[model samples]
Target: MGPDQALYVVATPIGNLADMVPRAVEVLQCADLVAAEDTRHSQRLFSHFDIDTPLVAYHDHSDDQRTARIIERLEAGETVALISDAGTPLISDPGYRLVREARNRGIRVVPVPGACAFVAALSAAGLPSDRFTFEGFLPAKSGARARTLEQLAGEERTMVFYEAPHRVADTLDAMAEAFGEHREAVIARELTKAFETFHMAPLAELAAWVRADSNQQRGEIVLMVRGAERKAGATLDDESQRVMKLLMAELPPKRAAAVAAEITGVNKKVLYNWGLEQK
Candidate 1:
């Protein structure tokens, strides 16, 4: 059997129809079967591209038997393409079980990579991208979500999260609290679509803005938070703290942080954050 016998993990567009990659189209058209997160949702995509391949429902809920059937088809020399409702398969979506089992069975698993909302958002987010973490969607409950963010309190690498439209406001407030209200964060909403927007600000400010503007809460949201700054050098000495406090009483926080950094040899941003905490 040739490549057609293997399992194909295809990436569909996140929002823009034009984001669909050509190779993905060819694979979907040629595959013997397409297992989708939602067959009904995938049908619209297939219709747009005039692809009439057989469809089957596969999602996080798909049982072992469903996966076994797909694997058997692949083993029997029938190519099967796995796709999510949108974006790349298995990125906070389903198909992990099928993909892992396929590899275990020594079936060739090919990737048709394309649009990924978090990656696309991170690219234009203006956050430090050299190193980062993808923290998918946070827990919906306040207690679990708070605990989750608390674990990342010291995360120095940029952090990315996917948030539901309904829970956006609550998540932002929770993030601001756990990560420090002054921490920098970016909200990328409705990416790759006509009304797409990217809003960057401090966590507290971003949360406030999103709360005041109902429109920002209505679409797909990718939240990018600047990592906790590593405070280089030793902890602040008594003299430095004394001077910073005195300076803050007289000058603005920015100027106080600058002057304190000069005298204390600590990061100005660090001093600024300390001042914020002290307030």
Candidate 2:
């Protein structure tokens, strides 16, 4: 409302410099101060836009003492802008404490939306976007990643995850194992850059491709894994699981799914994968 009463949470471009919105740039340029998750990284973005506003470091690693300082600035009627290194602040990055503190201190929190990699990837993932969940990034360790995947194994909504270049292949392999090798998925990398690529395929195929081509291992990666296809059967009894096996062994996937669908009233495509996963 008033000129000096708000803290703006601004979204910056993920990669492509041109993706920056004019209004976001203007806000950052005019803000009293910018509380950046990484002053050095944010400086690059600020320099790109020629924004000379002073930046104060505020990140997850920073303690409450730092938060107190930022809160003091806000309380003093400074219009601070919070920005992460890339994309939106607080998505998988820092900003929660500052936002909460600002609100608690009666400071207005304004969100100036712009480019977000997860949303951009989801729009083009070709998977069902109507019902989806953003998991940010999975744990790096094998057991942890597997446990994470296991918890989501039965989830029926599409899921998105961010993975570093070096870990994308390993994550994909883990996804294939936990979610089933044939689970449909897509990988979007170097998004909005000249080398931007989107690969849509079965999890197994993507994993294999990544292993075979070293080039696929580079760039910031956004993975979209199709949710577990719900099985429709009268409930998989000994008889049905046996029938599922025989049908999958004897008929093509399409025909098998159709037969399974008829037998259990579950969606054909979903039952088809359930049958395959059974194998």
Candidate 3:
């Protein structure tokens, strides 16, 4: 029997078309159908590469009907290729539902990896790439975004995030506030395209730079922040301990530790140990 039908998750270029892998092109050209995040936006890519495969829209709003249709095609031994408007399918894009359903139905899923904005940016950001977290995009609202940043303030793994042009400055300002002014960060903009730029500095300085230059606010942005330094013989601060005690009064020790970690960005283990010592 022929090899089992599969869904190919292909990655395209972030900006520069030259980065499109030959294998990805071949998969797109050969697939029976192409599931794209945005059919209109992907048209340019199809036109550029002369890929005439039938395109179907699949995005965040795509209902189960769409996914079911794709799975049905896969089950019938038809090959389908999934592509996001740019980069890899489902990095911060749609296709998760389709992929999951395909797997549950015993359909093989193959990844034709290529360009990814976060990976590309992290590779050259000069931060600790050994351990990193890709926190896709920040919340649109300033207050919510700040709260999210606060939760990750003590993250030891390098944090990567995507920000729209208009909110880039505000996001940087929030980062500066949540992670101290001296936290090192790298702002990579327009990556893999003409006018691509990378600016590295302390969080406060980076925020100031973006604020002063309107140009910096434009383009696709990947922001990388250095992980919190692990100090030797580190102990919980008095403020954190005080908060933990107050929480413990109203909640169980474990619950208090968790909440304290979220509010103060302190390590949960440390708080838990402190809580145990108190009891």
Give the TM-score of each candidate.
Answer: 0.83, 0.82, 0.86
Per-residue lDDT of 1-279 in model 1, one digit per residue for the tens?
A: 224678999999989999999899999999999999999998899999999999999998889999999999989989999999999999999999999999999999999999999999999999999999999999989988986786686678999999999999899899888889999999999999999999999999999999999999998899999998786544567887898999999876657989999988888877876765565
lDDT per residue as tens, model 2, 109-130: 9999998999999999899999
Give candidate 2 misplaced runs (Cα > 4 Å).
1-4, 233-279
Give the least accurate 10-residue stretch of model 3, judged by summed lDDT.
1-10
Model 2 has an lDDT value of: 0.85
Best by TM-score: 3
Distance from true position, residue 181, model 1, in Å? 0.9
Alpha carbon lDDT of each predicted model: 0.90, 0.85, 0.90
RMSD of 3: 5.2
Which candidate do you rate higher for TM-score, 2 or 3?
3
Model 3, 134-242: lDDT tens per residue?
9999999987897678668767799999999999988988999888899999999999999999999999999999999999999889999998877454478899988
Clashes of each: 0, 0, 0
Q: Would you list the clashing residue pairs of candidate 3?
A: none
